[model samples]
Target: MLSDTIAAISTALGEAAISVLRVSGPQALQVAAQAFKLPPKLTPRMAHLVHAMDGEGNTFDHGLLLHFQGPASYTGEDIIEFHGHGGVLVTQRLLERLLACGARAAEPGEFTQRAFLNGKMDLTQAEAVMDLIHAQSTLALRAANEQLGGAVGRVAQAMQQEIIPVLAHIEAYIDFPEEDISPETGAALLLRLDAVLGRAQKLISTSEQGRILRHGARTVISGEPNVGKSSLLNLLLGFERAIVSPMAGTTRDTIEEIIQVHGIPLRLVDTAGLRESTDDIERVGIQRTERELERADLVIEVVDASQPPSGVHRLSLPPAVASRRILVLNKPELGIHPGWSSEPAAIPLSCVTESGIEQLRDAIRAVIATAGPLAADHPIAINARHKAAFERCAARITAARAALQSAEAPEFIALEIREALQALGDVIGQVDVEQILDVIFSTFCIGK
Candidate 1:
């Protein structure tokens, strides 16, 4: 595959200003010469207007031609791009001409796969490319960019570096079975092992937040009948996503919408009020609300602020969500009751006036932050694959520590350390990962 020239439509096939078709390989310039004329003095990366022709030398279109020399291109190969008309058929004609000239059709993610194979980036950066494209919120975008810049890879590399010296020391003692490790060497090894173990544990702790960034947080809004739940939902979304009414049980089903709070996307589910109902329809809605509550990552309990403190509706939450709940005092525009007017913990919100909306957003982000070890702005991202690798690395380090503590054979300690190094290497693709390369890159879109 690497020996063949490849061509593809690099831009989306739609009516835009222009669509880009790309060709890259050892013979990229030669393959492009069949359909487009390139001057012998053409400068690399310089744009020029060229007439496109088919196999019979018939002119079809005219556009810009640019070339990126090999070893400096996206895939570390000779690359050429055709900027042609945005019409779908026009773009397809140009791409077909290139393929007919002498270029194979690129498979999904082939461009990035080639980039990875050519040593332009590591596995984490490769995965981050898709993450950057599908990011639902700005915070997720920032996290993807950080990972793309080698955030987790740097940590894994540091751990590997710290373990190398310790491994050499342990292996030194392993060579001589009769001799035991010196006290100073033993202490030094323990210290370095602990240092690497600490980083592994810290990186593993961020796996939860990594999932949250990839997938929007599941947030559910619950309250008594007619407590402005729909009002709050609409206010958060900056539009009337849900119908607002004075009648209780107006909403007999759960309404879901995703809203970005301080750059974090929260999948807000506005549910029917939790109250005793006689109608079968209302009862079913309430049942659905209960199920939604069970799996919610964050629950917003809205209460009427015009009523006395004792009258505040308190919906019983599942034990899992007890600490992850935010109390909202809605309808405060009606007049804050004296009983709870002094309460500072609850957000005094007025959906009509939009007062305290910003504060409520801040509170939501704060509560979610408290739910996990995402204390850092850009926590080390370890997706499911990275998490498993880090877990193996940490487990091996722990085993090495245990072996040292028990004064086991030096060979046993050395073996564990080596395995730990391999596991860590897998995270950054320093070790064999051909099996997972397809799975990771398959999720990427064609033309990168």
Candidate 2:
């Protein structure tokens, strides 16, 4: 059992209507009683108005005190909440009084960590708490909520269940060498392995979309000078995020902003126009633009619809970048330039008139949709850590399937299956404690 109580200001610190200070552990009620004058009987999950005081018995403030008995609270311990006026000084004083009464300050994510330790939630649900806190778009919020509701946990558990029988069969074969395993049993084992492999691959496939939802997709807008690149950025952002100019090379640096298009968050980067320039600053900006292109998830290649297609040669982009490129013919309000429109892949758009912008949005949605449609029911692994775990799990399952196909010994197949199970366990955090706990919990807010 946990020995000491932990306390923290659960709400954002500042002046507001109310601020909540949370305390949990065995000593939680005793600590709260020391600082709060309450009725003789305190009901669990019920709030009572009381005068919060300090060690000297001087009243610091008046607030609502809520008591939650152990094994039922958020941290599965005796919990107390002091809901008081939302002044920074008042909240800090209350926390200080609680600390003085023998309650230690809760660390960043300590509450949620306690929840995980006490069986109130799993590692995935604990992570979703932070994800929900940082969610930038509606889709991200929904995904986080689903994850909190055990979407990823259920999938991980299912995959783990599938691997156990395979390991059992392999172990049985190992123990009973005299009992010749028939071809039928081996074939059935292979079939079972294949099914699990397919499931793991499907889960791994959602990683990209999950990542895109968690961290907005990095999209770089590129082209020669004055192709309405800034205009496109401004139009997409719905404001003047970049300087719009008729002159060449007005934007000497990359301007980046986040916007949600079709419920997909995009980290849109408006890069310096690609062109040979003698100006030192412009050259540096262009270099940065090139670097941005290298790391971009999507490249919106803007072209001047009023100008001829020959200017495309100025970009001199790499083939890899060219592969993920979307040709956008801007200034369509002026008129579509003859040769470029005929190139079927180019999307004609007019940032000046805001026409075809919806089509451009749809195209971006299509690119994201490559990972498969975003549905509320889909279980996605929403971060690099989860994605890496899923990928490793899939790789192990694939290796096991290959070993089975090559007629490897049951021992070898079992070893591979065991490794796969370990990998899946890491996903839901059933194993591997010290490896990822710090990294995962460090991202959380202090009060959480």
Shift in Å, residue 312, candidate 1: 11
Q: What is the C-alpha RMSD of each candidate to the true structure, in Å?
A: 7.5, 7.6
Instruction: Give candidate 1's root-mean-square deviation (CA, Å).
Output: 7.5
Displacement of residue 114 (Cα, Å) in model 1 is 1.4
lDDT of each: 0.83, 0.82
What lDDT is obtained when candidate 2 is compared to the true structure? Answer: 0.82
Candidate 2: tens digits of C-alpha lDDT, residues 215-255: 88889998988988999999999889899889999999999
Who wins the TM-score comparison? 2
Candidate 1 lowest-lDDT run of ten = 438-447
- Cα lDDT tens digits for candidate 1, 1-448: 8998899998887888998999989989998889897777768989989989988898988899999998999999999998988988888889899989889999988888888888888888889999999888887888898889888888888888787767655654455334543323667878999999898888888787887777878999998989899999999999999999999999899999876787777899999998889999999999999999999899998888898765434667788887788889998879888777566688999998999998998998898786455524655657889989989999999999999989998789878988998998888888533422332234222135
Candidate 2 lowest-lDDT run of ten:
438-447
| Clash count of each predicted structure | 0, 0
The parts of candidate 1 lying over 4 Å away from their true place are: 175-184, 278-281, 307-313, 337-344, 372-376, 432-448
